[model samples]
Target: MTDTQPRTGAPAKPQGFAATERIESPQGGGPGRGPMVGGMVAQKAMTFGPSAKRMVRRMRPEAAPALLVVALSVISVVLMSIGPRLLGHATDLVFRGFLGRRLADIPSDQLPDAAKAQGVVPGVGVDFTAVGHWLALTLAVYVVAAFFGWLAGYVLNGVVQRTVQRMRQEVEEKIHRLPLGYFDRSPRGEVLSRVTNDIDNVSQTLQQTMSQLLTSIMTVFAVLAMMFWISPLLAVIALISVPLSLVVTRTIMKRSQGQFVAQWRRTGQLNAHIEESFSGHALVKVFGRQGEVEDVFAEHNQGLYGVSFKAQFISGLIMPTMMFIGNLNYVVVAVVGGLRVASGQLSVGDVQAFVQYTRQFNQPLTTVASMSNLLQSGVASAERVFELLDAEEEPVTGLDVPQRDGGGEVAFEHVAFSYDPDRPLITDLSLIARPGQTVAIVGPTGAGKTTLVNLVMRFYDLDGGRITLDGVDIATLSREALRSRIGMVLQDTWLFGGTIRDNIAYGRPGATDEEVRAAARATFVDRFVHSLPDGYDTIVDEEGSNLSAGERQLLTIARAFLTDPALLILDEATSSVDTRTELLVQQAMAALRADRTSFVIAHRLSTIRDADLILVMESGAIVEQGTHDELLRADGAYARLYRSQFAAVEAA
Candidate 1:
């Protein structure tokens, strides 16, 4: 996504930057700029690169520890590889010694006539003491090598686990620092997949794939070196398989990488669909669209399966191809080594060692080919993760304009806004709420009542004009500082999964237990809370499903009360509650609104009859405004709305 600069209080035009650049200066450079750059430059660096480059950047400076571990692991693998060859040599030596002993056991008279003619006896043999001493030396070498090999594997595994742990922690921190708008545009499941699934894939790649790859590479080199020491001619023939196997591996990797990318994308899509379905299960059931949702989910599931199958199928071919090449190399080495021994150019021991080296070389190749699939999957996952880390954050820039403390006066001057620029939701809207006054905004759905509030809160910057709090332009103040003085209760109460006391205290985190209960009593929520099984200590389920809608609304109002904010916003807060509960909520609201600036967006005209000023809004603009009696005398839009509500009440 392209990056746009944060708008300034002055009328100067703002400048834009490339998404990859760190916004060091505000749109228009001035005083009161933020301490750090607007967005993370390091995250952007990782966004566009190969998997290896991205992985290296993601590891950060902490990778130094992991690198040291990896180096030690490589050394261990080398020692282990050498150890196996040493053991094989010792086995051959033992066999040869046994052969000599067997010949010595034969009687001198049992010698063949050809042996007698040549003055050679079957019973004659080399010194057993010398042969035993040589065998002991080979066994010692074998034992030492095996010990080092085990040590290497153990050390490397620890390093791999620790490195992955650090990486996961860093990724989670980045996710939290990203802006709210980023979450708005992206699917929850897709974001969650990166944090959960992508990190998991990378961990597996480190723990299993990288370890196997390192061991295989070291073993292959060690075996090839031993083969060259034994028989240079056989080594030369064995080296041919190297390029052949590499070609096969490169082809498989190239084909598998694209499939892996597609597979991960499909997996994310499937996860997003599943999360959407579950979150909206109630709506789906109410609409009788469960079958339709099932069909859509099945389609996504099948798509994921198909892509995963193709990715795995291509990667799965690498192992068999390497094995085929390995078998061919083995036969060639054996035949050539046999011929050389027959020509008396090589000893039987040398031929035996050469054949063993050839097998060892093939074994590592098979291992590396097997690990290619995991490597590809990890690379794909890293690409997705980096994409998120690289996303642009919201702009934060402006001077600190001092606001009047607890004044609670809000004024909009010719303000305009649009969810999309081409379609304005509010046009040239202007209004004012005096200190300690209750302003009620009345309108049909999509009449921009909420949009007006959003602009007032600076949730979205105005396309035109300005919004000021206590005569100070809001755009010039810090968003966090300004929002702190305002308390909002939305129609849909979002109570996090926590104890009732904790949710109430969310409005003022440091509030005492007595203070929390006082706030609850002011909102008339204490009665219901105390009646619960665990009273105020009861744990609410997700979205506070354990409580009725009216109780949830009361809890939200109680939370707002605890904050004791100068400006309180109740946006259709009592719309869903029953009549009796609504009356209780109104009584609580009356108590909470004492000496406070309040804005109530009410559908029921009765709730707003006592408001100091009632604004009649139509199509984003204020059509009429006056006190209840003044508006009723004027017989304007407010009068019509009041009469309509009065008629409805009388009819009921």
Candidate 2:
């Protein structure tokens, strides 16, 4: 059968992601892989409940410490709440003493009839001793309350900081398990935002808002209980304002929730644009698109500003509205309680205490209403993080077949695949590479040359077909086992932040200094590396900007050389270097491929002229296959490709 089967139906596009090649920034901390574009599109606000439960579940390891934080917070709020009531009692004592002194000034027969009828003793003196005792008790309560508050803060900081540290670690680990396709479709900025920004939001909430939330909620209930204990009549009046505050708070939250969601999403977009701009600053200036870039940033920034202002302005109204209701309650309490006091049914001190309680009751309500926005923003951040943690991971559950030894054999039988299945890019294509053979893959852009390499590496699974290595179906082998036998060097070279020696030893970690140096020598990296002052000890920054592009390519070659895999795939491996370096790299490749199976995807047709097998592909189907001489003799697609490149080089 031919490589391609006849079309049956149109291809279906994949959902939730676009088909795009992944781009890695040479600058460190550039846009990361995430779902947002330019990091600025307004995402739908996620529900808070599930995300909250997930975080609580994840933080279970710190349960004991978290519980301790809650206990301390509760004790602190209780202690603080009691301080006001005790001070109120002291006020009552002082007021009583003043009245006693006044009564003492009058003779028993001359005393007011109401006082006499109420059985007030004549010639009574002010009780300074009792007043002093009340003052001391109030001071002690306040001091103890302050101490509890300090202690709670100390314990809570430890718990929150530690929990956030663990959360960051888990998120880092989760990124490694995700599939390559996820990165292919998502922007790097959005991913970076989640790892750094979103996590920080959750961290800040834990540190500043968690204990405060508990304390504010508890304070509300405690103040209400004290109000009831003092006088039920005034307490009932105070209660009327609670429902009013609730209605105001609910209205503000409903309006502000959508704004908060939009605010965070726009923030992410602004970040994405900034990252993209910085990384491609040279390109922006070359194209004279700086103004356009600035305009886009302004648009995103303005969007964020509008939403954030609205959310804050709306949520901001809660405190004042609650305070106004509180003051209104206080006035009513004062007026009615004064009448009761004049009738000797209530003391002036009791009225003062009830007013304080009413104020205290409003304080927590205001804090909680304010906290609602912060909590929502925090939960929104948490949803992004949880979304990443919950992304579909690349599965690794196949049988653990042993890695093939020596030169490897590869075969693709009726391979069918596509980035978006409905738009089939490759169909029933098949090819084979015998042991110790060099297979050269050539095709126009989007003709599935890289896709073929991707399939062979199992970076993606096939829709229909089995690929075999050493006569064993690869599906039966664990991904680790299968990939362990192969080595690759791509056009984009990546190096981590470390000493040169460390990076060269990355592929075969724990490789000796001698072995690393030997591999570097093989790839000709030693020529430039040894000339440097630090030699192999030089530090490469996060982006590897310390080295030139060609230098980075040399290091990656050294890394792959150290692996000594049975199979090697090189996609435009020597495209970065000058002609002189290209010759050196070709020589190195020739020596490396002497007894190993290799696949070379080359745009420079001349480079693969010596390859044992040349597969000239067009639109995902192999149209011609033969050695260089045979292909020129056939005068087909391969010959035309060769003639075109030969003419271009001659003209240059």
Candidate 3:
């Protein structure tokens, strides 16, 4: 391949995790209530079946409580459903007394017992006692229904809380099992969004939507059944509206679904852009690209507005359209019931009950309409979460790896490796480092310097050949076992939020305070720590931003010294320090390297002149290997690199 051409490697590909929308949360916003803009504003249309099924399977443990909630909800709704029918009887009793009509073609036995009782005025009668009795029964049913409703909510909340906690735990555990390559390829913000935003979406849905959905569904079926029982004619009239409402809902959703998808996808893209722009703000300003950056942001903002407006507009139609259709059904039911009542084909009480049932029927339809967007957004978030959970994890092969001898001898025997198997980066590479020797590797950028370090750490499995440490195959060793015996200090230092003392003792978590201080002193880190106001107790913020780059490097070196591992890997460890600090660091490093095997990957050829072995690499292969002076005498790749660096320094 030409230098400018790209090379394809592995034919095998890892599963692609879905990109999630960047939801902008309002201050103190809790889950579903959060004010989302951009991607969150638009709902993406996608099938939620797989994700929903997976969630249901995972929620099996909480099935009993869910079922209990369902049962309670059903009982509460059934009691409430009886209220309209009983109230109608009370209305009919009063109407009968006023109209002076008792015996009709309808059977007297079908009438309530209260209606059959004699009135005080004989023909011109009022059944006061019967009305009171009917009123009392209706009130009792409602009171009991209210109690059951509250209990159902209480049980639902507990179950949802426990289930959400379990989901969060699983996601955290999954994070630990994912390979380092996954992190390397994926954006940290995107991954974070899944863990926090997407999971939170699921939690909110379970807590709020689950109950509402169950109630709406049950209410619809109960209302329909009651309507049919009252009069099949009015029930048919209500059923006509169902098809019309569904048609409207489906049409609008078909349009809004795509927009929702666009909104969320664009939202993720917009967030990624903002993150990149902010991170590289200095670079943008230095290159006078502020206007360009603004233009880019404006373009993204405009795109979001267009898609979100469309999505909101389309979804907004659902409630109003359903409402209009439901009212039309209501009008027809009322007119037809009135005619039937006048003709004595239906009783006044039956007409009243049917009207109430019609109104109740529309209620669930309205609820379902209003909840359409929330359900869509929730399902979208769920799918994204499930995608993450279903990602491929690092396999654990519990093979018995023989323990390495104490010598720490390392060897690479004809190793053939490639980042992409289609194009080999390193072919038939061979190297050996006897115990207690300092081996320096110098190479240009893209020469696979870091790749070598990655291999030694077993960050990626080798495609072919074997790497042995003291004659024990590294592949046979567990990653934890192999890595525990090695200590590494890289150019890009990392420090967590903790005290300076804690950072120094990171590699050896069990080290006492004195042991930590001793390690720091050995690395000359104590010199700086003592100068600080808090000394060893000084707090280091995340990434050690409070400390200078060189100081961060110093702390990492101290951490490595604390472990005193058999094998040490230093990658440009002193590149950040000044000349004076560099000299001191070098002195400390020399003492630390005593009787320990070390591999120093350096750009500064001068620092490794005294190394027992120097491997000069170019294009992923070592072109020269020898003592520094011996390589200089040979006048090859190493000599040219050294001469060029020295020339540049002298010229400057």
For this target, which candidate reaches the highest lDDT against the unseen true structure? 2
**Tens-digit lDDT string for candidate 1 (598-639):** 888877888888999888776566777888899999988888
**Evaluation by TM-score, superior candidate among 2 and 3:** 2
Candidates in order, TM-scores: namely 0.83, 0.91, 0.87
Point out where model 1 deviates above 4 Å. 1-49, 98-171, 398-404, 632-652
lDDT tens digits by residue: candidate 2, 1-652: 2566433432322221212222232222223332223423224557666766776676677788778867777777777777777776677666655666667767778866545433456556556687788778878877887777777788778878888898899899888778775654446676788889999999987777877777888888888888888889888998898888889988887778777767777777778788878877878888888888889889988999998999888878877887788788878988988887777776666777777787788777778877887877888788777777777898875787676575788898988887655556677887889888999988665455777777777777888988888888887788788888888888878899999999999989789999999999999999999788899999998679989999999999899899998889888888788889989989998999888899998888878989999998776678889898999999999889888888978999
Tell me how far the alpha carbon of residue 205 in candidate 2 is from the true structure, in angstroms, after superposition: 1.7
Candidate 2 positional error at 304, Å: 1.7
> Whole-model Cα lDDT per candidate?
0.71, 0.78, 0.76
Q: Which ten residues in a row have the lowest lDDT in candidate 2?
A: 12-21
Q: What is the lDDT of residue 14 in candidate 3?
A: 18
- Put the candidates in lDDT order, highest first: 2, 3, 1
Q: Give the residue spans of candidate 3 off by over 4 A.
A: 1-46, 100-133, 285-288, 398-405
Q: List, residue by residue over 1-652, the lDDT tens digit for candidate 3.
A: 0111222322222111210111112232212121121123222344755656777677779889989999999999898889999998898778877645444434645654444432212254458899999999999999998999889999989888888899899899998888765754455555776788777878887777777878888888887888899899879988899888888988887777667666655665567567667756768888888887788789888998998798788888999998999899989999998887765667778889888988888888888887777666666677766666777887764354536557678898877666555556677788898888999988776566666677887777787788888888888888888888899988777898999998888989799999998888888898888789999999999767678889998998999999888889998889888889998988988988887789998888889988999987665677788998999999998999999999999999
lDDT of 3 at 544: 78
Stretches off by above 4 angstroms in model 2 are: 5-43, 108-122, 400-404
